[model samples]
Target: MVAVIAGPDEMVGRSLPFSELSDCPYVVLLGEPGSGKSTVFETAAKAASRSVTIARALRVSGGQHVESPLFVDALDEDRSEGSKKDKIFQLRDKMLSSSLECWRISCRVEDWRGAADLSALQAATTGAPIVVTQLQNLSVREQAKILTSRGALDPEGFIGQARRHGAASFLECPSSDKMGVLT
Candidate 1:
């Protein structure tokens, strides 16, 4: 059931059903790069209404406790992308062994999982090959929100980058209440 198909630099974003999104003990958000996966994580953090602890996948090593809801970004990627899978497995073991509220991890769609999927598909097609490309650009409102969040999060850097990138159009977008992030 294709509900909304996109045109041009757009895509039909998908996720686990809302029930699973809200109820799952752990969830992974996978997408093409710049597909607003970070925004989804932030929105989920807001909805969870718990102490949010975020860590980059590289920094997720060591004796991390389960004191609060944790969101680890880019679990399937790192400078040592291949070696990091061991760490991910270890983290999973740790999470299962610990008491926790909830947790999530995000990764690029072209990372390990996508690589494996593509490889299998290509082999099945007699090595004709397959390629994955960017799926969508942020909507006007989402762009504005991202701009605001970026500025708030990194005022100096965002100012320079926004000007250089000619992102002034993002300023014209209307704001959304966006209260349904959880739902």
Candidate 2:
């Protein structure tokens, strides 16, 4: 179906519509910076009816006024430096709480603390079968470069491993995915 979405100037420019999300239990969007997380909500909101309520994470922290399903931009600049871990746990708790019908969160994989937070979020969400999407960066080459620089990846070794496994490599690639911190 062809979906209609309102532009940025509209009231629903960056929030999802209630009808579009009523069936979804909860979702967590995972990716790096500038990965179009806001766009997803914006598109969903365009088709929604007017008067749907939405709020960001900062406002939620100050006073728990926003109702579910809440759309939280976890990568927003307003997040405090020292309170990231706490914020994540709070979000997790809120998302999983009985009061919330649904919730959505976005975070960058490159954020070291967020990386840890994702694991905890993943663990909690798994029981509820939440949808998770990894939005690939616009520049795949740059994405590879970031991984290499982080020492989380070794390009040469990856390519060599890929060659060894032939077409089946990705089926078992990024070996790190299977390795623990101590491994």
Candidate 3:
């Protein structure tokens, strides 16, 4: 049976049925260089502007717990692009594994060399709102593999695998949101 499509007002911008965004503790940002991943983060932050405290994990038992607002900007400038990727991934894993109470995350990957592997990890992981973007070109199949392999969203078969992933993924453009837009 075919169901009727609803309007945004009816659904309130919800595009997925099994959505768990309300309770999501984290948001994973993924994309290739110049894909506007940063822009999206800024836009989403602006959309849900609020200062919520978040806890950071510690290695030692009974260790000091760090707290900060829900906003997390893990982008790095001094380090090499590859190092930056590692930093984000490490932070992501830590946040996911710990009992931290974080609401939003903002990450950017300007390097595509390690994008596929990282994206796959993000998609497969549960309990978070993940956004992956890329400015580089890879076959649609490659993109699909990364998303599905990580368990983000699934397409029916091989054909479905040849598409994009995330709540939204797009090419970079001048219209992209600025960091201040979120502030």
Candidate 3: segments with Cα more than 4 A from true spot = 1-27, 32-35, 51-71, 74-85, 88-90, 93-98, 101-183
**lDDT at 124 for candidate 3?**
29
Candidate 2 segments exceeding 4 Å error: 1-23, 48-63, 76-85, 94-98, 112-119, 122-127, 137-183
Could you give candidate 2's per-residue lDDT for residues 135-167 as a string of tens digits?
Answer: 432233433443466674565565455457673
The candidate, 1 or 3, that scores higher on TM-score is 1
Candidate 3 vs. true structure, TM-score: 0.35
Per-residue C-alpha lDDT of model 1 across residues 56-87, encoded as one tens digit per residue:
43245466556445665665455244553445
Residue 180 displacement (Å), model 2: 43
lDDT of each: 0.44, 0.45, 0.37
| Residue-pair clashes per candidate | 0, 0, 9
The top-ranked prediction according to TM-score is 1
**What does each candidate score in C-alpha RMSD?**
11.2, 14.7, 14.8
* lDDT of model number 3: 0.37
Could you give the candidate ranking by lDDT, starting with the highest?
A: 2, 1, 3
